[model samples]
Each structure stands twice: as structure tokens, then as C-alpha cells.
Target: MATFAMTRERIFRELVERSNRSGNAIWLARMIASWRVGEGALPDYLGLSPEQFNNLRSHCFSDIALPHLAVSGKTVDYSRMLEKQDLETLLGDFRAPDVAETEWIIAILVAGCLGSDHLWQDLGLWSRSELSGLMSHNFPELAARNNKDMKWKKFLYKQLCEMEGLNLCRAPSCQVCQDYGLCFASEESTSVIDQVERNFNRDA
Candidate 1:
């Protein structure tokens, strides 16, 4: 497992260095590198279709070919279920007016939300701050609405709930919410390898 992880890490470094054509190169590299390698494929886990992955590949790693990666059965057909029509509409409505050709980033983000981790970790971003950078640049309107610095995942769901007229949050306001920590806790993440090391040590 360690050896396999090292090879994936190598792939990440190479991709990060070579990916320069778009603003999302490092994002893609982190996601591809940190992806699981069992029972699923790369595109399956990232919530991208085979063609979408290929398009992203052409944009980021045009001359490179990634190894066949396996993903878990959990993510099979995930994009269809997670990519809800209303959710996409919500994100689409807030698409940065100044940024051109940002639909793909929205697709990636919607798919990424299906994961069980913090939004940034699920998207294979290095940290919450990195995810914030993407959001601020690509969906500045939505980003600006998060005046409380709430966790991205929490903020997104809150937005969705409000849009759909669903009062999911129990608190009257975020500041007084019983689940305040869950929504506003500090989010610090590291490289994929470093994350594994931390988990390994914790379990040791």
C-alpha cells in the first residue's frame, strides 16, 4: 500500500508541474493523485464522466497518460444521483459573471460534494483555503454570500436548502446554531501522502 501511494504521489508532482494550461490544473492533479485505487475508476470517483475526464485531461495533461486506477463500488453512477438538476441550477445561477468557460468547474464541484469528507478533501484539494480560492474565483457571488466563514460544505448545503425552501438547519442563525462547530470549525488539510501518514499514526 505504501509503495502504491508513493507512485501516486509521484504522479501528482509530475502533473502539478506539467499542468499549466488552465487554472484548475493543480486541483485536477490533487484529485487524480488522491483518488482511491479499488473497485472503481478515476472518473467514477471524481463524479466526471469518461468524456469529461478526458476533456479535463486534454486541458491539463495533454501529453500524459495516467495509469488505470480503481475506485470503490460506492462511487459507481454517483454523478447521476449527486448532480441534481436544482443543485446545478443553484450553482449555475451564481457562476462568476467575469469568468468565461466555468461550467466544467461547477460540474466538478457538484460531483465532489458527494464524497464523505470536507468538500476540499473530497475534491482532493490541499486545504479548505484552496477550495475557497476556487470558489472565490469561479463563483464569487456564492463565495461572497458566505459572510460567516462557514465550512464550504455546510455553506453549500445551506444555500441549497434556502433555495429549495427547506428549513434544514435547526438554528435561527449560524452564529447561534447548535451545530456551530460542525459548520465553522477550522479546516486544515495536507498532501495526500501526509494525510495517510497522519491517519496511519493515529491508528498505530
Candidate 2:
């Protein structure tokens, strides 16, 4: 498994390097290469319309293809994020001052909000640090506010909760909360990106 892990890691690095390696390309490549959205069509999982997906595919993954994408139609509808429009607006407001196409990223992150795992895992991003990098790149102000390094999903929802003047978690003080681990715990031992690389090497 260790040997295969290295192979997977090398394969992933090569794929990113082979591509343009722009921040957008790297993020898209990580998600696409991860292949972890086991239950939905790629575009829907990525919170993108078919047109948007196609454009990104052409620009970022032109040299790589996946069977998952060929499975057409929306397997799951993440459109109704349960009254989370305010959250979307907040994300947009903090988007990087100099970047383009961040709205697409905001849409993707909003779609990811509907998942049960960590936000990065839900987005098939492979690692928490990668998610952090993306956030720092595109939502620097908001990301900077996460001084305690709270989990991205928890942090985002917490931010949303605070923005709406609600304390849904009911933990006015996190230090005393029983679910502190849920907010600040470390990720699992294996990077899901390894799984993505395995799948990419096997199927792409």
C-alpha cells in the first residue's frame, strides 16, 4: 500500500505539472482526479452547469478524462442548500479582490455545504491543507479570520450562523462544548487525494 501510495502521489503531481498548474487548474485537477464524489454527476457535484463544467474541462483537464463525468444528468440536486443563500452572498462578498471566476468557486463550495464530511472531503479535494490553500487564495479575508484553524466546513457554517445572528451550535463558547472535536479535530491519516490518484491511474 505504501508503494502504491507513492505511485499515486507521483501520478497526481505529474498530472498537475502536466497541466497549466494555475490555481484554478490545480484545484479542479485535484477534485477531478480525486474521483471521490461516488454518488453524483461531476458537474452537479462541482456546483457547475454543464456549460461551466465543459469550459473548465477544456481548460483544466483537456489531457485527462474520467468515466464519472460521462455519467450524465444530476444524480443529486444541491441547489436547495436549505435557506443558505445568505451564506452564498457572504462567500461572494469575501472573494479574492484580484481573482476571476470566483463565483464558480463559491457555487462549488455552497454545493459542498450539503455533504456530510469535511468540506474538503466533500469537494473531493484530497486534503484539508489543499482546501486551506484554495480558501486563502480566493477568500483570503474570510480565511484569515479562521485564526484558530477551525475545520473549514464547521467554520463556514459557524460564520453563516453568526452572520444570521443565530447560534445554531448552541456553543456560545467553543472551549466548553462537548463537540469541540467536531470543530477542531485533525483529518484522517490518509489523504483522499491518494484515492483519487488510484482511481485516475486505474481509469483515466
Clashing pairs in 1: 38-70, 38-71, 39-71, 40-71
Model 2 residue pairs with clashes: none
Q: After superposition, how far is residue 61 of candidate 2 from its true place, in Å?
A: 4.0
Report the C-alpha lDDT of model 1 over 1-204, residue by residue, as the tens digit.
Answer: 597577767877888887764666666676677664331122452566667667767767777876433454445354466536666898899888765436777777877676666788767666678888888888888899998899897888888888778897777877887788988888784444566677678999
lDDT for predicted candidate 1 compared with the true structure? 0.70
Give the Cα-based TM-score of candidate 1 against the true structure: 0.79
Candidate 2 to truth, TM: 0.75
Our model 1 lands, by Cα RMSD against the true structure, at: 3.6
Per-residue alpha-carbon lDDT of model 2 for 20-80, expressed as tens digits? 6667767766665544334212344366766766666566656755343422244446456
Backbone clashes under 3 angstroms, per model: 4, 0
List CA RMSD, all candidates.
Answer: 3.6, 5.1
**Can you give the lDDT of residue 4 in candidate 1?**
57
